[model samples]
Target: MASLLFYMSATVLFAQSTVAFNCSINPIYVDIHKRAVHGTDIFQYGSFIGVGTPAQNQSLWPSLSQNITSFASLSYCTNNSTTLKECTKSTGGFFDASTSDTFRELEDFNTLDNDRNGTFDGAYGRDNMHLYTHYFETDGASETRLTDVTIEIAQKGDIAPSIVGIGRESTVLDALYAQGLITGKTYALYIGHGFDRAKGAVNGSNVFGGYDSGRFTGEVHKYPMSPDTKNPMTVRVKDIIINDAAVPNGEVSLFDQAAFPDMKSTPTPFQAEITTDQYPLALPYQITQNFIKHLDAQKDNYWGDNSLKLKSQFNGSLSIVLDDGFTVTLPSEVLSNWSNITPIQDRDENSTSPNYLSTAFLGQIYLMADYEDHSFYLAEAVQKNNMVMPVSWCPKTGAPQAYQRPQQNAWIKQGLIGAVVGGILGGIGISVCAYCFIVAYLRKREEKKIEKDLERSKAAKIEQMEIEEAPEFEGPPKTPKTATPFFWKKRRS
Candidate 1:
């Protein structure tokens, strides 16, 4: 009787373990919604997330520099704007602390600087955060909710969008992993070319704990995450090339002295951080000037963000070469459009500026970060299909591998065809051929079932075993007093 009871208890435990393991292994996918925000002429791409206890919905941009999720507080718009209409338009959406019953303020209103030229006055607090799979803010079919997640309510700051930070510190990803909602503390991003939806642009993808294999193409280049916690995702720019007719090869390197003899010095490879804070590829002043001169671009004073307007639209394409031999080419439309170009200011002979490969650059490549493994990968962006294959990055799995479709063996296909033809042509041994085919098919099916069962059994065993403690993540370093804060310059007219 004791042995029977033991067996029943073990079965119950195994069933519960399997259920928990399956839930943890599934990844959370957040789709980027293209909506007409008040300030911008072109449509913006952002994820619509719900915050607070009552679920105040807000369209927040995914920020790499920020450590916690931030919302424009009710005070921010009331103090900054003259009217309610302007407030809602400018702030994307605001959160009322009084309305949320679960909100608990941890820190009073204070100035917060993100080292990346982003200085804002905000109050730190803990609240319920919700991530939705649907693009619409109203819909909540498959929502992942976390209670008492750290958040910031911004009162006043530079013209910026409310952002959900996916940084190196204890971010939303970490919270999800800790709660066993996700398999690992990792995420992948594919900022689609959906800025102008009218012109065939599609919504971007932001997958937590895994990557959408269909979003990228070509060989994926891997790199170790930067030691600088402030800028974990950094890549070196080797050369900038433009398609030029006057040149012998119809391509001219911006760094080549022969091409631009007036250049004071030859530009060397420089590191740039990949961020989603803003659009435009922020390069060193020298490189920016070289690009401006080559393209005959002029400053758009109206924009007030150091945006360059092309005098005569450049018809040729522009290509950026990375240190790893990976190249990303931009079409003539991107080069001609003034809104797509911005120069890194305060960067000259003596001074240096924060070089960034911002949102615009992300539209052309796939970015995947494995915080646990301290590694990241980049691949050419592909939008050929909307197929999604989410690969889980469990603690046991370490790093999530990109999914590849299995190619069918030619021999198997040929053999099957030969068997069918032989059966039809020659009556002799027809029954034997049919029996063989049925046996092979049944064997393949049975093998698959066995493999799945084995995986489930292993997962249950792992769940039953004691889990090892993960290494502590290092905290962000203090921001320098002299460091300039970068702000989102987009504002309503």
Candidate 2:
């Protein structure tokens, strides 16, 4: 009996597990706040996280390459001759070890360059971290807290601000998975265009363990993670084309040798890393030169070596075709406007120049990374939608399919239809069973009646035979005959 009870309990638990798996898998959606970072004119999208014992909120950028989360220290601003408010505005917020009792320094000040830009002096430590879904939450009700998380306090550096690394390492995603806040070690990002809320700029979002399907459009291309673990999300560019009235087909490839004969060499397909640490699309020197010549652009000494300004007006869209046949086209406004200048830059024709697609590229495409599977996906970004559909990756299948919501009345209608159909089928089955049972019972009753008649007929025949075999004499004569037969029988014996 105990074993039977155990089996029954197991069956119930299995059914519950099945139901949970088929239901919607909710992912953690980290919404980005649109505002300008300190010391920069361009409006940036960042998430607000709390740190320390009392939960001092800090705005931090999501780094795709770095694993360790770092925040600018209060000393960093003083060293740079900046005030606390300005520093706070610039670097999200500064970390003050003196204020937090839980802060523990793990390593002394040392130079670190994890961002690949340059080196900075900082101390490694552990502290409490808080992540929230909304920016305006002050009550800490929605906070997801982590204890003794590895963090950095940047004492001196030219680093922009605090950054939460979501790379393939022991990062926050791993911590979230460990805490059961998310299902898997996966995340998706879509950096929408324009930061000015007054000018109709849409905000972007970062999701953990899932993706927002409404933020992207078209077919998604899946790419295997590069064996080079440091730069796993690398893509190859096939060609760069732009719309030009001067060209025969109303468009021209930047790689066209005849059109730009002065290029250093024939342009070919090349690999580039996708990163969020910078904002320019770094390309080969030859391709950058081709763009410069076609657009009648001149170097902007004020901006930097790679920055350029238009010498002649050109209204044409720039399209980048990937080796996988996915094309992302940049509108003319993104190419022409001064605010959006320097979208493309040269990766100096040298051995050390790294070819990469920077944060600007992410502004046009949606990126989803699944570290557990060592794969990533890319799709064209959409800016106008307000839909916030977050879908999870199936733990068993490793597929991130969105949970499609049926129409408002669909479930009810389907349920009613199913009930009516099932009822009709059930009724037909029951009636057929009843008819067969009634026919069988009647046949059984008829068989029993035939048996009774046979028994009665046999008994009547026996009685009739007995009557016929009786002696022909009357009652008085039969007694004398019986006595004579008895005496003869005794003598014979």
Candidate 3:
């Protein structure tokens, strides 16, 4: 049976309009383990959260953003020819027919399995358009934090997925920009979520290479004001969220040093009595869909007043079958054009006392709202960093406190000035040259047009002359032939 699920987002400009969301059933669920509060749990809503009434319906981005704000379908987009479609009669997921192996078979076996098994209400041909959650937040008037913060995977079925879930991963700002996600440059949120809590330094285990030399801190987030500020420690970083991508138990940052002096770093030293606490999940999540929507605006179409509309299409869809038979359908994930992860170097690269050298994983994708915003994120950050470093990463959208917005009019005025200058130069050059060299060629075109017209005129005149001349020949048969009796005989051989 064929099924059609319609999704429409009617939104106004960011500043003038606020987004109010109401789905037939948007739900989200979060499950958290509290180490500090012992035996406690915290739940935050997510993806399926959009399916229900607005539990949290406040604009993360304001009115100026309203003009460009968007709600996108999250999933995978494929060439369709890249992977063959395999019809399934059971709970649906991406089943690679070529190898008959699932993504779960490749990684996160049990967790993946658990997610897959929970996805069906017994329909054979449900076009599962799964929703992948990305954390977004509006803090104060400056709206901040749009990143791959919390990534929850869900599908629409007879039942809805829960929205309460914790976020994961750091902000993906720079990568998003290069890929063109958000527009006008906004802040991004990086999230930290899992169990446990701390208010101080979190050291890493057995560090070898860092800015200050080979040091080891075995924790995450070590609060500077902690009682044991100097001692190695690991404080919980759950409240620190970058964007939509959350940092699960192991996804916290591999900081130059722990948030606390006693914080955590990845690759803990293999030793006894070296107190290596389990870290938050290492947040390395990427979206499966990149192309959100292609838009076009028509003026004066509505009420004869100025207004605009957007046209969008989902590239394609993907299937996810969790271990427990939870099948989720999603659109294709878009990819940032391949680029090198250039090193972040300070002015003292060759000097013994260099300023900053981040030990970050190379090639992390940062998603922005759009090209302009991406540029602003980088440009502003560069200025803020005082251009001291050659290159640095951009923060994601929705996290504005970290940045200062630019004046819009000044930028536009500069463009107008440049255009005027170009116009003047072009005009002057045209006046000086008069395109003299090509005068003959242009003249020739006119000449050809005239020549064709003249030829037609002459041809018509000649025809008229012929008609006038015809009367002379028709006047009388000059010297008419006389009848003569002459016998001719045919001789046959």
Candidate 4:
């Protein structure tokens, strides 16, 4: 979710010992996408994919015809908020089939229909209509594709233009794995703290099959990735603490389920998932009200936008207790802050939901996910500008590989324990241990590689499987119909 289920680079210094993953990072842009006609065209808004073929709406973008990567003409669907009429103000864009030779349309439908809600909802409740399938891979990160991969084109109204899906089932990552572009099924992210003017222009990284160790410091807290891959990644939140004082568990829910009709109405201890897509730390209404009381914060308009703003004099930090016993304490700045809200479809621009909630969708925290082991690491982020970090792939744990036996390490074990106890070490003691750990790790790695190589050299002859002819891509039926909703127009809300 931190990678934008709907949703890193370079070798740099880390203040503490960290794990390096074998992943590749690419430079991505965030464009605001306003045309010159509005005189509001230049600022950038974050997007997973860069410029593609020109769309039908190319005329709207005065600069579209000049850009080489501009291949497809963007088409604007009818705005379903009021009437099913063509949208003139909507600025959303996507990869149009008429423009790209390698574009292959698969099926278009609501991907997040866990509750049979007849709508698509991200883990944090960001709703949109999606079209998914494979396409030719070019540009972006060189290591990203060895062949064609799947992509999800989102029509999220004005909230998000279009973003690449990095979820478990995303075929883009799958294509990378199937072609051996990456060693395993994994990706890493570093969502920076630059979503608003106060933080300024901040860039984050997205890596395939690994994570960059240089972006984070302190003891990394590793938690098992959720087995339910279809749903967004979720963690066990044991409790919430405000200023060293624990909040009553039954008093308020972790998130606002009212937006989700199928979900329970009562408060639950830990139902929240980690996400980089949503800005606020969304919470139940009751809990949010309670927190406001705790901060003794008064409501104020953010700029002239009149969005939810809190003027709090309290500066104490907030701590979250994970199911694994790891407690992460966030400073007041991150725990209590504001960002421009992504307006929802059919909702008043001035009345978009609260900016901060009990959801804990804070971007200041650093996270690392390992898809193979179905686990991820969490820690406070250490921000650096123009930073680039490389990833290293460690041997798989709890699972055996083609030429390697399953392996485990005390580093992870000790790291987990330390995180649980909040026993982060510093000074010479930590430095000495870090040195020893690196030395032992390198030695073990070299030894394993040599041993595996020797085994391959002495192995007997083996028979290879027969090759099969590739199947042709026959597009979906002209009138394919089913319970799953398909729309080139409006989302079935």
TM-scores of all models? 0.70, 0.70, 0.17, 0.50
Better of 2 and 3 by TM-score: 2
TM-score of 1: 0.70
Error of 1 at 475 (Å): 99
* Candidate 2 residue pairs that clash: none
Q: What's the lDDT for all of these models?
A: 0.71, 0.71, 0.22, 0.41
Report lDDT (Cα) of residue 488, candidate 1.
Answer: 39
TM-score winner, 2 or 4: 2
Candidate 4 stretches greater than 4 Å from native: 1-41, 51-73, 77-94, 107-146, 154-158, 197-201, 228-231, 244-269, 284-286, 297-308, 311-314, 336-362, 394-493
**Model 3, 490: alpha-carbon shift in Å?**
74
Q: Which candidate is the best by TM-score?
A: 1
lDDT of 1 at 345: 26
lDDT tens digits, residue span 341-439, model 2: 557765455646667787667778889898866888898887666567877753334444433456667657669768878999999999999999999
Q: 123, model 4: CA deviation in Å?
A: 22
lDDT agreement of model 1 with the native? 0.71
lDDT of 3 by residue, 320-353 (tens): 2222232222212211101211111112113332
Residue-level lDDT tens digits of model 4 in 1-493? 4444322112222211223333343212121122222112333333233322221222111110010111112332333432211233323343355454455545543343232101222212111111111111132222122334443333323333333445545544555566655656665565554434225344555555555556566666776656543234567765555662344442232333542334445445655456433344544444444445544444444422222444534345666667777666655565554442211111232443422212133344556556656676776565563344545443243221111223757766458766645544554667899999999999999999999987765552222323333545544446755556544542222
Worst 10 residues of 3 by lDDT: 205-214
